[model samples]
Target: MAWPNPFRRRTAKTVSHYGYTFEWTDEHLSEEDAHKLRFTYDELADRVLARLDAISPPQKQPPSATATSTTEKASSVESEQSKPASRDLYALLRDNKDSDPVLRELWDQVTTVPEWVDWPQIGRGQDVFYRYGGPNLTGLAYQALLGGMGGARVVETLARTGGFSIKVARRRLFETTQHVLQVTRSLDALEPGKGEGFESTVRVRLLHAAVRKRILGLAQARPSYYSVAEHGVPINDLDSAATIATFSSTLIWLSLPRQGIFMRSAEAADYIAMWRYVAYLIGAPTDFFSTPSRAKAFMQSVFLYEIRPTQTSVLLANNIITALHHQPPGYASAEFLSASARWLNGPQLSDALQLPRVSLYYSLLMLGQCAFFAFVSYTYRAVDAWDRKKIEVLRKVFWQVVVESRYGLEGKTTDFDFNGPGLILWGLFQHVVRPQLHWSEISRCRSCFKLLPARESTRMYGVHALII
Candidate 1:
């Protein structure tokens, strides 16, 4: 007899995100206005978009904050910023700060640190990631991206770029991990003009611009291909803002707590601050993610605003799991991934994405997995002697254990190469060397107490970060 196709549609047309969707409005703006901005894309990156002769710059129609006329995009042809394309963005900013009008203006904007930024808190925030590194990563892959497939509009843009395509899933995952790592690599990694975080974030900004232009070009070529009126700009401001929330607020409110891990109020705030700076650098609307409460509300408001999954959502979600099966830091099976995705995202959303049902064995294994992380987290949190300095030590340990191991994976990298301009190579490890860590560890960590299975020289799934 023939088997069933998990990719087949599971009737998600009427489904909605089960989470509470709050109405978002700050003192300065209303929900109605934010909706208008939702259809908007970044305008500052228009100059870089002009250089690509292969595509036309997207016109944001008329009478909107995001609206950019073709004449304005074409006007860049005469601007000095459109000179040689080979010059790296960082070096261009350094060497031609005086010459490039675009970089100069952006430089002044991003470099001037906001008075509210608290460096010590940011440092502790970095620790929060590594503090529960394993479960947090599981949260990222299973909850943030895979479960995030519910956002139909975001998936619309992702589908257009073939980003979550079966072949590109691991690359996309690792690249995102690297961006998180770089920005949180160290307290000083965000030092405006001279840090890895600063440089990489800016590169991502340019990449976002490029993608927006590419899609806008496609929509322009074939009107039926994409609807700006219906879908908004390629990567509109709301989309970008929501993207940042997935990495931060989603982790704090949804991903971590669901896995039996929870951050204290302070840790949550600092973590939000780290991503808030990232929002600023990436040109996402920042005030929305300014504090823990604000970020949570924005995330909830976004779920209310979007989260209607479609057939494409099912395809992309399953495709990511299939592509990354038996691969990477977590050499997880499709069943293992589905189980975790289901747990982290709950049954309602998982059902909408058409995630296959796993046996109770996998569920118990997940329970064991959460128990292990809770042990580690509880130990760390209970250690009264473990001060901010200990957190710093933990950060270094994470750098050595996880980050260092990732570097030489098939001679890939323990560090990012900024010698180039684009963010294409951010997730190069998938291509450079795809190491099969320890998918067995998911089971092992679950059964570590009783069975004590012999760990194959590699590490386990999400339990890669050993507190030692």
Candidate 2:
């Protein structure tokens, strides 16, 4: 009689991804993708179950084979495992990134830079980033995570490091804010070389290089679950493309009108183009999202094929909401964060993530915030000089409130490094050096709980200030 292994879990049915039916072959597959192609879903299930059975307690041999078992264990040790042939992993990763046919095919089909897309016009687009569309950056970050963490590999990796935990909120928000500022500054740079430098900073490049190295190493180390040979990169070119599209097209462009904020077509195009350029600098594939329309289409395709409702997504979203619940100035309540997420990603995604339903009053409050912004958006474009000036004052007040909400008026920060493996290391460090701060006891912002701050006395806009 055999004892059944509980670990030998089987999925109810094989779910096909949206783009899986495309006539791609083994030659076009990554080692990870190709490894999967070697077996049908049923065969793979059978193989997994068989492996589980072999390792099951019932299958253990008697003590007579102890010597053989010891010898096998010695060989199976991590230090004794046979090393692969000497080759550059970085070179291999670059080759994979460049040679991926699926990504190349998608790029060719989707990318279309318009003839009138003036590269210079992107400079003017920075005004919009810090002005009308600033508050929605948080929503965009949530959207990116919602999409990126859909993959089991990414979510599991993030989960193990405890990065998605509540204690890491300040660090995460700061890093995200840095990235946002970098993109905005890069677009507004006067010198081509200076602009390139901002995009390709040593810290930024090192951070990207470190991340790529870690991801590939993770794939190599965890072959059965995560394989570069099987899946390629965890955050592959397509994922990066989707991320760029989500930020530039989906969150920025789509959210504006839905939130009742308005922008002229030309202004929107400039904004998209600016982000398209940022996408290139971030090592996302060139020309894949050259136009706003292409970005939208790419986002749709990615959401269908790559993004899905998974336990992993829910776990990450839980972490984000918990973390935001702890962070400074405290206007962004857990309820507001949940509601904003629902507003941005829709009810299906919100429910999939197991977020609590926001109350009707909060929903109306969210709409009111949007309406106020929509008024600001329109008033900024008024022909009269004084009308526009008053709007600018309002925009300044909003910006001050946002900054204070995240980092406070003095912007006090912990001495942790903001570059290299800082975030990665910090998240891991929290498990040991855990600071048990009582989040709810922290003081709430007077502005958010009370009336809006006076526009005349708002702080000067120095942090990532717009050239306009």
Candidate 3:
């Protein structure tokens, strides 16, 4: 027989078997042998622990008094340097430039002189043009809107363009080169005669990185609502983030020594003009008026007693003839005539053309125009009788005009611009003026009275004259 296969197993059935029986080859290991090859949990745990114990512990260090003292001294030096320098606005302006001989001489005298920082707060009206006065073109534009020229499109356009220009200047110019110079100057000043080193350079780089990151964060949060075409080339995709970053960086550059000395001076002049324009729009405080209060009061008396009476007669004559066609039958004609006469004779009308009251008058003019439009629609049953589609479109335009008008009314003139006025005027022309002048080409003309010459005002006014 061939040699038996040692790994082979044999199985058999027996008549008197006590249990199922099986046979293994001699080459196969027994159960006890298999168990001997394996390690128990206890043995594995011991082996791992023994290996870990073989590694050595790190050595400890003792405290050093000299090193501690050095650290304390370094911290004290840092604290001294951290204190901000006392800034003199005038001196700050002078130290930056020696190129202008006139300014250089002026700067020399300014250093020895004392000046008011907050001139407006100190009751010095002439000093309001100074940088510290807090009123500028931006503030003036805001005030003008509050006075009633709430032209949303125009304000918004101006704000967007102006903001973008400022943004571009700050990002491409101030933040990059000028900011670096400022940082270097600050570092040099802090070190006395010592030059800036690698450490300061690294710190400046880190600060720039942080500022850029903040700027990026703002840009990502408030993406531009307007198109690149709207802002122009420099600030094509400028968004709120870019705007905030630019503003912050510009403010920083302006505050730096020497960099913004001349720029700030020029800006001060612009600020005054802006403030005056704004003051004109909103009716300035009584104290700001050139004439005395008594003089203004006397003028009011003259206007009410003399000038107004003549105007009233003219208005009465016009209303009497116009009322027959426009007014409903019965007491309507009489009531409108009486109201017209009363309004012409009213103290409010006299005050309307005066300082302070001009704002009120403008407001009333706008309101009356709106009310007259509404009255015409009601009288002709035009709005209520319109098709659903026309009504919906009109409704949308109405709300848009109203909301933008109100925004313009609020002191948010910077929020809109000329475009806003155009849009409102367009809406009014489409909804109100269009219906009344459907037969005339003049009525349909979008730019009818916008820039018409003074001579054409009467002719154009007649062309769009309301039946009401």
Candidate 4:
């Protein structure tokens, strides 16, 4: 059913950007390259084969080890050759559709790959994330749409942390912006260890692992408050992780197209492919959706099956809007943020989050901003090479506003004071009081009423346990 993109033009041609010309086709990749793009069978099969060999190996050593090895290799090659040559996921998905009725039904009426699966262009046009007003727009979109609607469990966790609220909100926001930028850079390159290796890969991995550890510890300490059914299994399970990851991948692409920061079908494919690889590295399940269309499907599934907003969702959204309102540069206002939330999430969700109704002035300003960016996004490509300096300045200007937002308010002060007895007692409770509950055998299962893990001493439990 799928071949050579028959739905599109097939005439041999050249396209040029920045004096560079390249062919556009589904065949941009060689067969070997396509194989490289997908998963490898040898890795998975090796583990199962190794276990089988250990249990059922020949008792006697071969008389000639070399001959036995050669025979084994020959058999392996014969088995491989007898099987289908194409083992890539796309191929496997198609081949298994008949036997796997579910797979067939899932993709049953789907055709032509959504008209937006242009991988080649996406790969080459990775600059869209930062070059246009992508950072601001996406940051806004996340606050309004993804974070606003993903239920109480995820947002409530952030709210209770108090890390970004009481301790150091400015620093947290800066770190978040940096993380977004780093991910953008990594996606542009889209290789495991390329371009800011630790920043791109290890940083996020460690952050996610630390988050998991902290959540597990919290659940263990306070079963009454946090539990599997409430928080979702594994704390950050496939569904939640997929939602969070797609916010940056598919959601970003979806948001940008309206603002004139558009990506071709192939460009969207490359963007999603980059994130899929990143999600794998960070230990998030990528099996749900390997393409943008599938990601969109996964998103739709979220609304129908996953999300159920509550009081906690409202509190978290309010917290996010409040924090953004205080940040420097003075642009993110209550009215502005609420209006953007309303526009992005629609009236129903906006009401769910309890966002104030849109203000006329802010709404018009936001609209103007989008229109201006759309103009720039479309026209600037012709002058992109020559406009590097201006683009850099624009990037700097955005960050400058961000920095000002961090520390720019009048009468700003960092001095914090609390009652002396209350302060000392709270410290004692955190360091001295909390430890007793943590070490107590009875306290271990006080909330959940389940057996605690063997290594409880090594784990810490408290609000400050996992800040990063």
Candidate 5:
């Protein structure tokens, strides 16, 4: 007994560590507890079995087969994501075979416009007054009357009326109607129908018919598809005909300077309509104030008045207040505003010298870089104190310029602000706030820096970089 220690004895009564020893007892686990224990045992056993299996053997498989499977899955995902969400004309036609002939005719009439018509060749740029001059005056005047009753009304109306849902429709109607009036005024402008004379050609007739039908269809679809505010108030609740008429008149007035090239009133109107329609479809504003210059001003104001100057401006204001019992150091709101104002209004020698049209685009690119820097500086200061969502919204508005500048629809060279907005947007992207999310394609295009020959790259880089 003294020779053998009980702890070290190898005997049948000694329990083996690796093996289970079952003993019957009166105590019993509840169903849940028993199930949990069983599950734990199963998991442990499965892990053990897996380890044993991994060390036990290796399965032979074809590398090509595995690669093909992975490739197929990736291809499937890419295809699904790449497909456009909207229905095409042909598909819509095929789907609506059983509909009324009138509706079908309307659809056919609208779809007749070629998807890729050479808009410039069709005299798309005829209305110089409505396109540029009128808007410029209005925008300049509007900007001057800062924080007035008129300004308040304008802001309120715009805020209430313009939203994601009805924006496209409103834009379409505004653009098309304006162009129609412009072309109507310029009798010598190109006609969509057959060639040149008073007699309507098939192309012109077809185009006109298509435009009319599309307009009608848009009108009909408005009630159903249009977005309403929380109070069920439609964005375009204002008198449609009056609003559109005024808008059209304003556009025609702006494009008056280009009247000579349009030659005919009809051509000018058509061209203006097409141009505005295209702009609207691409999520652009119809007026100059909505342009980058104005947008920048608005953003600056928001940052100064609503964001930095207020107690609620910073991300960590509340946190700081709570931690320090409301006796935390006060941020210099005025200093921040002054700094931002200086950045915005700062004189740059480059802007004074007018470069060639192509060179001008590059200048915009530089401005965009400046904007990006401003955004980074501002955001960095507030990041610790602001709500993530609020920060993101501000960032998005700023970055929109960058994205729009790069991917926006093409516009004419004479439309400086239209194209320049993209440059301003680049500035906004760079300065206002950094976007929390980014598209690689957009980023790549924005990142592209080169001053190519004006003639060669104007359309290429200009089209790709700034809004046309």
Candidate 6:
């Protein structure tokens, strides 16, 4: 069944979102993309798992059938149905790339770069993440993950995994954060076969496949466990597209502006392009983010079309805020987190999710942060040296991440231990302090307003206008 799209249209192809309207080509969301919900990554990761399971079947086995050659393919299908949880696609690729045809093909497919990819642009894109480190971190934490609980499919899968439960929500948040931080570590880090970014991304794909495979098995054995018809296959293309969009488009347009930080035209394109490459590697549709405008439209469409906040959304949102409360000395507070949810997601969705009200303390902190970020962003954008210095400080704060293996998969796990008063102080002031004001006019002021009342005052005022 095709999931109804609010933006799917024939004539005008325009949709209203949060008081703004966006128009995209009919190519944006096709019938094929819609039905992709019923499918997962079958060609590579799924195929590799199917083969590995039979070669090394689980220790437990069902009674052998009396039949033989006539049912060769049938038995392969049955073996897959009750296969081992996974054979560690990454390790299997490492151990058997030369010996296993399927694993070799899977590795080859992901490592090869498409003709459209610009290596230099990809390198620049990696820099964009760290360039505006504080706002991006804030956006991912407050808006992307927490705000994303409104999705029916993504939220449902996360709920089943218990990753977002109060007990492990904090760990879940850091685990995800670590992947992002690692992926954008450096330009060289993104090169296929050599970079950790490429390796991490491929490993992450297998984890998603594992979740889908496990959940599919559960649903088959107990039909009531999950309704594929209703919820779509776990982490399908649209969901994957939405996941990457949350990290890219949402941060560029919605989240950063909420903190009074804005990207230049080139900066915005580079950031979107960076995530587009990630989408390509993970089997998500890359065309959706081919340009800055297209990426923004995709995010707006997902926001209006996909967000259907239920009680589950409310529970997850609260869990996220509570899970990160008082994380480190002077680092974070409930007042800040609640206010951030209210600010980043807007009052309507936040209220729908039943997020707590923003207290006066939250308001004052937001005010202080907006003014500070605007100053910082403008000051650095105007001077190259100052920009580097700002990024250095911001990097030190978020770079305090630790990588760990979980569920018996190396390079497939992420955890963070945030401590130390000095680190906490810098991180808190930089990322923990929340900002809610948006200043769009400030973004273009350098070119728009150069002439002013006085000569010397004009340059400084022009810089200030860029931050206003």
**Which digits, one per residue and each the tens of the lDDT, describe model 2 over residues 171-267?**
5545445455444543444233334223232223224334444445556677664555444454445545555665566655545655666567776
Q: What is the number of residue pairs that collide in model 1?
A: 2
Off by over 4 Å in 2: 1-119, 141-157, 160-162, 186-202, 222-225, 229-231, 384-468
lDDT per prediction? Answer: 0.66, 0.46, 0.25, 0.41, 0.26, 0.64
**Alpha carbon RMSD to native, model 1:** 10.6
The TM-score obtained by model 3 is: 0.16
The positional error of residue 27 in candidate 3, measured at the CA in angstroms, is 88
lDDT of 4 by residue, 426-467 (tens): 000001101112334323322221223434454223211110
| Candidate 6, 225-250: lDDT as tens digits | 88888788877777888888988998
**Candidate with the greatest lDDT versus the true structure:** 1
lDDT of 5 by residue, 208-248 (tens): 22222323344457844322321122112111111222233
TM-scores for all predictions: 0.76, 0.59, 0.16, 0.54, 0.25, 0.76
Worst 10-residue lDDT window for candidate 1 reads: 425-434
Q: Tens-digit lDDT track for model 3 on 400-468?
A: 322223211111111111110111100001112221222233323323223222332233223222221
Name the runs in model 1 displaced over 4 angstroms. 1-16, 19-31, 48-87, 384-468
- The TM-score of candidate 6 is 0.76
Off by over 4 Å in 5: 1-102, 108-247, 252-468
Q: Which tens-of-lDDT digit does each residue in 1-468 have in candidate 1?
A: 011235555453222346432333443244586679767767876563353322322333233323657887677566838543332444444555565566577778778888878888877787787676666667777887887788887787788766677765665565666677778888789999888888878767767776776678779999987888878887789888888888889888877777777789988999999888888888888888777888887787777667878998999889877887776444666777788788887777888899999999877777777777677676766775654444555455434433444421222322322221122211222211112245354343332212224565644433333431
